[model samples]
Target: MQSLFFKIFLWFCVIVVLVGVSIETSSILANYYETRWQGVLHTIMPMEAEKCARMYETSGKQAVQNYLDDLQRQKSVRFYFFDEDGNPLLDRSAPEVVQKMALNKEGLNRIAQQNLSAVNPRQGIAMRLVPGPSGRKYNLAFQQSPTLIMPVSEAVGTHPYYRLLGIGLFGALLCFLLTRNITKPIVRLRSAASEIAAGRLKTRVAPSVRRRYDEIGALGRDFDLMAEQIEALVAAQRDLLGDVSHELRSPLARLIVALGLLRQASPEEAPEYLSRIGQEADRLDKLIGQLLTLTRIESGVESTQREKFDLTNLVQEVAADGDFEARAHAREVRVVSADACTMSGAPEILRSAIENVVRNAIRHTPAETAVELTLKQTDDPKKPGALLRVRDHGSGVPERLLSDIFVPFHRVEGGAAGNSQGAGLGLAIAERIVRMHNGSIRARNAPDGGLIVEMELPTSWA
Candidate 1:
């Protein structure tokens, strides 16, 4: 997997697993040998003790000591041989852990007891009795599991090349942590980016990264915000696509049903089915046209041919036309103030944007309620722009769902105008066109009663 955490974890696991398995295997084998040697000592210690007796009588203490020394090295068992009176056969010291099995009558001093307190104790001392050649008894006491620790070279791969590599890695890791405190966050961001690129829209930078006050942290926060917007857009697009399919299916299905009825009908009923078929065809055409307009606006195709035009003139023209259309339905569209301001963009597309908003308001406003339009140049230096406000006398959108009105095919299901008569691409197209022109569109409820749709267009364009 292309996972940073997985990669790092795998690396650490490999090193630990290697070291652990090696040490564990060595220890297991060493323990097995230690056990076998302990068993063999039982069968042979007495024989060796008797041999020591003969060696001391004939050869000398030196020869017996040499013999025991060889056995200690070969069998890896520590020995402490003594006579019946408790004198060591060899001229060598033993660990205090095993000294209790063979001690002098005078016993150990207080200093020795305290000094040896820190010494680790073995399980027990293995003792064997043997008959001397001169008929005296001698005691052989030894400890099990004499150290089987391997040399550092063999145990740790301390060959020249490996040693250099290990040192280099250690130094690099130290330098990396010291010099690149930001790398981890960058890596996390890269990982998050990769995750999103792979279609995991919800993937986000780790919260630890976001909590930092540095640039990397800011980047993480921005990255997460971008991810959220992208996820929302993708979800909205998916929903729009599904809605488009469903919308298309309804009209196509109605057309099919109408055609079937027309085929089975007598001449008298054919006219009704033909009219119904024509109505379905017109619905499909309008939906498809609206879908195409939305696509063009979102893709910036409609606004490609920028031209200087008077927004005041554009607003008045749309108002007059909307007024004429609305009056037929007992509603009216009127301009409150058409401020004389000019801007560069596609006037026809901008015209479409204004028309859509006015039409929506007209559709929702009660009979005889005027859909009011306001246009003015804003004085805010940071955002010098032209603002348009369209207010309608109707039930406002729910506070929580005000922003959703501009989403394709999303309608505010309130009041008389909440029907699904439209494909719901009108405000969505207008929203995109305004954004492409480096402007913004937003809707909020007026304080009195009704919804206000605001559009802000920048004066200058790049």
Candidate 2:
């Protein structure tokens, strides 16, 4: 019973077997009460019946009844004696079918002419006519042995239990099929779960399970989805650890070298050594700060509260900041085209992202050139949003490396990883923050020269 297959199989088997037995019993009983008479046994039946009649004539009705009773017990045969007019000769009750054959002389003659005695009690009954003490005819009816003709007027088969055995085999087959249909999918799912628990993050349910159009299919699909997300998060985490350690090692080594130089240097050289140490410490701090920001945004810990603000104003403000910083490098930041567009997002977070892009452009633009910005709203049916473009008039990033710019610690070999350049985390942080606001960002080489970064974002109305 503890096994579901056994429980279901046994219960179904029992119910089916019971139903089969009931139907068989009902069929046998129906045949039992049937009025149709079976032909004579041609064995001890009519002969014994003649003895019953002679015994009745010699010893009277009671003694004949006793003799007949003894035969009934030993032979499983019932004897009925009738006079020539269809009246009972013995003090015993007979079935109505027997009485009917006796009363209908024509029907009785038709059967008797053929030397056969017709009787009821299901099959196996027989009848015969004999002379009585008064020199008149007598009809004697006796049933055949029930064991030979049992359960119906039809004769018994060679084997008594064949029907029951067939029914049992059919029930077992049905139960086996039913249990297999239900438990097969469950077994697959359990195996998948076990594999996953053993650190096989890529483990998935079989296609057979997933293709099923039922709740189990839905569960299988959801399980695969969860595994996919878990794998992605784990890989990202592992990469982050490796990148952080690699980035930290460089600055630490430099700081250690600077500390050694400072302690051994003369008074005049000490300040320079100390300053070098300070710069490495500051760079290390900035790198760590950007890492924290990226982690927060990626981990969904950063607040995403939204507010409506003018995109034009935010762009102009960022340009002014970049321009002020650029002035020292003989460069300028300017807004080329501006359209007043309102958008919804965490304003400070978006400000950081936009500022990062603008400053990166300013740092890359040539000393005599200007970094250009444009802001406008689009009404495309597929994506109604505002598109902001920032262009830097310097050597653009390599086309092959454009997509890599947003990855943490990614830097173009000869374009932006110079000794004086900032750590390559500004664009990475920008990408994460922009993604948090449900915006898309990408970079491409400008037509004439330099590089253009475009950000498409939904406006408040959109």
Top-TM-score structure, candidate number: 2
* Model 2 bad stretches (over 4 Å): 1-183, 381-383, 416-420
Candidate 1 displacement at residue 270 in angstroms: 1.3
lDDT of each: 0.76, 0.76
lDDT of 1 by residue, 330-390 (tens): 9888888876788888899889889988888888988979999999889776766899999
Per-model TM-score versus the true fold: 0.58, 0.65
lDDT value for candidate 1? 0.76
lDDT of 2 by residue, 153-272 (tens): 242233346555555676677777766856798899899889988989899999987886656667788989988998888897898789899889999999999999888899999989
